[model samples]
Target: MDTSAPVRILTVCTGNICRSPVAERLLQAGLDQAVPGGFEVASAGTRAMVGEPMQPISADIVRTFGGSPDHFAARQLTPNILRGVDLVLTMTSGHRGEVLQLDASLLKRTFTIREFARMLDVLDQRAADGVAEAGAAVVPSTADAHDGASPLAANAAYWRGLPARAAGVRHLSLPADSSENDIVDPYRRDPGVYRQMEDQLAPAIVSILRHARLNAPSAEAAAGPGS
Candidate 1:
């Protein structure tokens, strides 16, 4: 259905061509498959090799997971890019800090990609445990309770509320080790390092896609749809 702008998501990393590009493309592909025009995912780097294509290994990784890495050009992160972004998923904790340094206002909305995925996974499990959100909107009695909100608008509202909800459940979902929250950087590293990156990153991406499909608004029950 026609609606206002799609929810805007930004993925950040050191070069934009590796981890962030994979996150951006896969997320865009997954969300598009679930609900076309429902979200816009982009990527940038704190120290970008601007205009560069996705690194070969990273591009292959994207292809390995059913996402295309075509026509992607790295961009340097800026305050302007952060403006109006509904969510920001960074590759590392340091990158998350850099994102905040550019726009402190994003403190609540930004998360390390793995961390965010874990939080979503926790929420997904809670839903499976019969503790589902009343309407999947942030608040049913307040600002998010628009009766005629378009599906896209409802989607934006739901996702925009997630960081807060995720924050509230942080204690219940903390990683066993802090390092688990950050994706490993394999730039210029050996195949083993790239493998480590894949091992670390792929699961988080899967969690995100699974959770997104679980939460996406359905034509019959936006509580979820799509494979």
Candidate 2:
């Protein structure tokens, strides 16, 4: 798969108004900052609240994270939407299963948002090592390859290979504890529940953006000292 074309990513949840939209916007915002025209992000519900705006609290949270919730409306998930998407991120394990049921080939690309996050650091490290090894084999030395482009451009080229690297990541073992892989739905709950959702989601989203070679402000803060 030549990922040189725009990488289309879809986020799925039970209702489009809550988790999926939040993930959609955050991923978009991060990708916009990272690789301006390189990616596209969208969201849909397995069981939609069609034509509805994002839940007020969800919209508020989106704004808090520097995403505009303006003019947003819910849409139901469909096979057409999944047809060309490069990635599918779901809020829970069940949602991941639902997406896979719709299209089994998506199994290599679809993952619970939390599960993907947990696996990302290892995947990224593996990719970096692979890139370095390949570069060494072909170019002889990193110093010699610097003659053609600016460092930033070279860095971008390296990260652009991530989608392909992701195939290997998909085959790696996932953590055994399933509960750690889910993001509980907080719909109809109090503000505290929403906050809890944010706490869980914020880090996972950051990890994802990082794996995609995107900059995420929240992820940076979360990584403060050791990171």
RMSD of each: 4.3, 7.6
lDDT to native, each model: 0.83, 0.72
- Against the hidden reference, what TM-scores do the models get? 0.89, 0.76
Clash list (residue pairs), candidate 1: 217-222, 218-222
- The clash numbers for all candidates, in the given order, read 2, 0
User: Which 10-residue window in model 1 sums to the lowest lDDT?
Assistant: 218-227
* Span of 10 residues, lowest total lDDT, candidate 2: 136-145
* Model 1 CA deviation exceeding 4 Å by range: 1-3, 132-146, 220-227
For residues 1-227, could you state the per-residue lDDT of candidate 1 as single tens digits?
A: 23347889999999888889999998999889876788899999999999999999999989988999999999999999999998999999999999999999999999999998888888888878977554454443112335555566666666777788877777878989999888888889888888898898888888987876766664433323331
Error of 2 at 90 (Å): 0.5
Global lDDT of model 1:
0.83
